[model samples]
Target: MKGLVYKGNNTVKLQEEPMPKVEAPTDAVIRMTKTTICGSDLHIQRGHVPTVPVGRILGHEGVGVIEEVGPSVKSFKKGDKVLITAISSCAACGYCRRGMNSHCHTGGWMLGNTLGGTQAEYVKVAHADSSLYALPAGVDEGALVMLSDIFPTGLECGVICSKVQPGSTVVIVGAGPVGLAALITSQLYSPSQIIVIDMDENRLSVARDLGAHHTINNASGVAEAAAAVLKLTDGIGCDSVIEAVGVPASFELCQKIIAPGGMLANVGVHGASASLHLEDLWHHNIGITMGLVDTVTVPMLLKLVAAKRLDPSKLITHRFKFADMEKAYATFGDAAKHKALKVLIEYD
Candidate 1:
């Protein structure tokens, strides 16, 4: 088998590797059919995620067929098509019972981090029953790839955590995939205004096509962006502010634009410390939330996709073959240059 291996000092290569087999009672080995690059993968390559050691396979989002299953695995078997979840969870754990599967004691986010991931021909999945979703018949596998991470992250962390409500004003401070995912799901609540901010005009245009009521290019600076948002909100801030860009400046913009008593949901994965302006926010009763995506909403999101209420496939801006994994990474890494969003990599 061949897999993309991360080398130290921000490098990766597609190299020959041994195939994975079911190693645990609850494990299953998946033969990947489709996969995609994520912003987090870029973070890992940039040495932002220190826990990811070199020589690790580098991907968490994929759709595949079951090649083998351990004796204890019951929900799926060989030949079943499944969506590999980014976060692996043992449903029996305390955190899992509390619906915080991202922190599941035994298996949280093991794939593509602490364990081998889905970028290869075969990848081992721990907590198989809780970590993989059975594919519905006739659904687009490439689109289902989005459910493996971004959609659930956007819905759970960005939309739900921020408490987007009907008729409320919402602002998402990034036009990246996750930010667009948040923009897509936030509409389920019928927010009166869905404003998306990003420095990239191409992404902002894409956001508009995907239902963002307004788009702001932050190239002029955060103050100008905040002033524009305030003008849109009639001098008030948004009822919910989602910080989808995992950077200090983006987070600061979220702080400046959140309405008093509103929620600020930080959906981006931050590799560095970001300051929280407590002195400035002391009078604003705002709630701030951030965490890894639990993916508990995969089932509901599947139903929504089946109903045609959501179309994550629209986020797919580029495609590649398994042989083009390195090229795919290059395209996704310089996303602004490529005008890319989600870059899907299909297996031969």
Candidate 2:
């Protein structure tokens, strides 16, 4: 089997490794059909995620076919196509019961650290009954992979966390894949205004096509960007502001631009410390929530996809074979090519 191994900062390579097998009665093995390089993967490679170990496989978004199952695995079987959740979770935990699977107390994260991930020929899926979602037949693997992370993360942050209501004004502070996902998910709520802020013109254009009512280049200035956002809101700030970029500046901008009593949802992975002005937030009575998206949201997202409500095909801008994993990461990580929205690494 072939797998991607992160050796050090800015270093990743494909290497031959032993195939994974079901280690426990509740575990199952999957042969990956499609996987992707996430922005968070870049962070792990660049030493942004200090918790991730070197030489570990680094992918959390993937879809594949079940090749083998353990004795206790009842929900899945051989030949079943499935979408891998970003993290495996034991559904019996307190956190899992509340739908916060990402922070599950009983442990569920595989890949990149605990075990080899889906960025390979095969992966061992623990807690199979709770961790894998059966992919509907005829679904595009490239598009369906987004359900593992980017799409659901965006949907949770942009729609659910922000509590976006029809006719509400929403602002998203980034035009990256997550931001674009947020833009697409925001449409489900029928927000009156969807403003996207980013430094990249290409991404902003993509945001425009995805359904953002307006796009602002934050390079111009946060106040200037906020002014454009305000213009769309008829001189008031947006009712919901999503900090999709995760930096202090972007978070600050969201805090500054949100209307009083509004919701602020921070979706970006904060690699470093980001400060918040308590005084500024104290006067407004705003609600602030920031963290990783719950993997438990997969079932709801799957239902939407099954109902033909969410289509992420347009977000997959590039694809590469399993042999080209390193190159695919480089293309997706490069700041020069703003054209790569979501890079899908196909296994063939």
Candidate 3:
């Protein structure tokens, strides 16, 4: 079977590899039908994730059909359509019991990180019953694939963690896929103001259409951007500032725009260290929080999608065949030039 594998030295390759089988009593093998690369994949390629070794499969989000199930599996079987989860968890673990599945002792974030991921013809999912979502009849697999990571990440980390309240002002720094995902989900809380900030005018335009009350481009400088944000909020900072871009500048911008007693929720996966201005922030009584998605909201999000309250498919701007995955990577990597949000890789 053909699989996209990380070959180290900031690269990936589509290579022929052996098919995966059940590795444990709790595992299941699924044939991938559709998948997409993530921002995190780019992070891995750029040597951001040191734990990922060479030759590891490069994805964790997708939709697939069960080809086989281990003896212990009961919620799904052969022929079931499933949504692959990026974060794997053993539901019975202590961390999982507390709704912190991202830190599950045996299975947190194994897929596409510490284990072979979904960017291939087949993938063996550990803790299969807990790590996969059963597709409802007539749901679009392409959109469901987005929920496997971006939506949950946005909803759980950005929206909920930041405690976005109705009638409050919120600012999201960065309009990339994850930032847009956070923009989309943040509306659930009915924030009176949603300021979408980025360096890309194209993404800022998309963010405007997606429900941002204001958009700021950092083309000049963060100082100018901060001035613009304060102008919108009547010279006061935002009630909540969500950092969706993991870079030092974006994070620092979040600090600059956040209001006193506000929340700063960071949803980006940082590959480098960022400084915290505690001297400036200490007197403000602000709350700063960061986390990996526990994905406990997947069920509710599924219902929202089924009801047409959410449409993740609108985020898809490109598509490629499984064989064109390397090309897909190139396009996704050059998002600003390609005007890409998410690229779906359709299998033969």
- How big is the positional error of residue 106 in model 2, measured in Å on the Cα after superposition? 2.7
By lDDT, rank the candidates, best first.
1, 3, 2
After superposition, candidate 3 runs with Cα above 4 Å error:
none
Candidate 1 has a TM-score of 0.98
Q: Lowest-lDDT window of 10 residues in candidate 3?
A: 132-141
lDDT of each: 0.92, 0.84, 0.91
Q: Of the pair 1 and 2, which is ahead by TM-score?
A: 1
Please, what are the lDDT tens digits per residue for candidate 1 over residues 1-348? 999988878788899998987888999999999999989888889888889999999899999999999999999999999999899999998899999999999988888899988889889999999999998887888889999999999999999999999999999999999999999999999999999999999999999999898999999998999999999999889999999998898998999999999999998877678889999999999999998899999999988887888889999999999999999999999999999999999987
| Residue 205 displacement (Å), model 1 | 0.4
What is the lDDT for 216 in model 1?
92
Displacement of residue 214 (Cα, Å) in model 3 is: 0.8
Prediction 2 global C-alpha lDDT: 0.84
